[model samples]
Target: MTRIGVITFPGTLDDVDAARAVRLAGAEPASLWHKDADIHGVDAVVVPGGFSYGDYLRCGAIARFAPVMDEVIAAAGRGMPVLGICNGFQILTEAHLLPGALIRNDHQKFICREQRLRVESTTTAWTNLFDEGEEIVVPLKNGEGNFIASPDELDRLEGEGLVVFRYLDNPNGSARDIAGVRNQRGNVVGLMPHPEHAVEPGFGPDSPAGARQGVDGLRLFQSAISALVGA
Candidate 1:
């Protein structure tokens, strides 16, 4: 089975959910400690969302120096797929694994809701199961969800088709309504929404069917597994 590593920091709240998502998607979820510098030979890595390091200095400022991050950075550089969700996204930016930064929400308040997003590009490891221009609804909870970058960087992202997901309703004032992005090689992806939270049908957001039957986010995990397994 494909082994995917999920890192847990002091204040991590979504590590379990991320692991469950991976398991449901037919991969082995490996628990990785923040203080450890090894990855246990996992196939890929996921930096789950949470208030790591107590959100001190910044959302991900302190978590960037965690021992596991060194291995994550090196693996990512070696073409290992990595996905960062919410605060995890912040860490990726702070660690320079991806471009741009996530700042406070334009509304200046913590927001939590099922956010609608469009799959703008499927050229990344985490989004390969989605079709281009597909719309999906997933949970998003964060105080610093707004994504910002220089105009040049925005142009480059768009020009290279690196913007993986675009918010349909402009939830957090992200540039061009971007909800997620991929690195130049498409191996690394960072997004503000918590797809892991929406993987379970009964516990996820309510769908139009009115049965709380939402599993749109599961495709993301499945995509990563497929990417690693070459199936």
Candidate 2:
């Protein structure tokens, strides 16, 4: 089985959920401690959401310096599949793993809801399972979800098709309504939504039918495992 690591920092609230999602995706879930300096030979890594380091100094600022991050950074540089969700996305930016930064929501409040998103690029490791233009509903909860970057960077991301997901309705006021993005190599991806939270049918966000229960987010984990094994 493909082993996927889920890192747990001082105040991580969603590491367990990410692990469960990995398992559901037919991969072995490895629990990695923030104090550890290694990735434990996992096939992929997931930085789950939470108020890491008590959300001090900023949501993910302090957590970016955790011991586990050094290895994550190195592994990602080597093309390892890595997915950062919500506060995890913030840490990725702080660690310079993904371009751009997540700041306070334009509304200046913690927003929680089932967000609608369109799959913009399916070339990324975590999104290959989705088809381009696919619409998905995932749970999004955070205070600092606004994504921003320099004009040049934005132009590059757009030109290179690196933007992975886009919002159907602007939520946190992200530029171009971008809900997620991937690195130049497409191995690293970060998004301001809780895909792990929407992996299970009954437990996930409700679909329009109210009975079909959406698990649109499960494919992200499954896709990462497929990408690793294929490599």
Candidate 3:
């Protein structure tokens, strides 16, 4: 089975959810602790969301330096796939795996709700299962979810087709409605939304069919598994 590593920092709250998502996507989930330097031979990595390190200093400032991140960084540099969600996105930016930064929402308050996002680019490992320009619903809960980048960097990302997911409703005032982005190589992706939370149909965000029928986020893990297994 394709094994995906799910990292757990001191305050991580979504490792279990991420692991379940991997399992649902027909992959094995390996636990990677924050203080550990090993990656446990997992084929891919997921940095789950939560208030890592109690969100001190900054959203991901402290968690980005955890020992396991060192291995993750190296793996990502070698073209291994990596996905970061919510606070994980913050960590990715802090680790310099992705350009730009996440700041407090423009409203300066925590927001928690179902979010709609467009599949801006299907070229990345984490988004290849989705059709380009299709919309998806997922859960988004965060205080610092606003994504910002310099105009030059933003233009570069847009030009290079690195923007993976964009918000349909423009919540939190993220720059250009960017909800997710990928590395130039397309192996690493970071997003402010929680895809894992939406993997289960009956318990995820609401879909047009009815309440809690959204499983659109499951495609993310499935995409990675497909890439790894050559499916």
Which portions of model 3 miss their true places by more than 4 Å?
Answer: 208-212
Q: Write the per-residue lDDT of candidate 3 for residues 1-231, one digit (tens) a residue.
A: 899999999899999999999999899999999999789888999999999999999999999999999999999999899999999999999999999999999999999998988899898889888889887899999999999999999999899999999999988999999999999999999999999988876778766446437788899999999888773
Off by over 4 Å in 2: 206-212
Model 1 C-alpha lDDT per residue in residues 1-231, reported as the tens digit of each score: 899999999999999999999999999999999999799999999999999999999999999999999999999999999999999999999999999999999999999999888899887889988889877889999999999999999999899998999988998788899898999988999999999988877778854445447788898899998888883
In TM-score terms, candidate 1 sits at 0.96
lDDT of 3 at 20: 97
Each prediction's TM-score against the native? 0.96, 0.96, 0.97
Clashes in each model (backbone N, CA, C under 3 Å)? 0, 0, 0
Residue-level error in angstroms, candidate 2, position 53: 0.3
Tell me how far the alpha carbon of residue 216 in candidate 1 is from the true structure, in angstroms, after superposition.
Answer: 0.6
Query: What does candidate 2's lDDT look like per residue over 144-202, in tens digits?
Result: 99999999999998999989999999888899898898999999999998999888878
Backbone clashes, candidate 2: 0
Candidate 1 wrong stretches, greater than 4 Å = 206-212
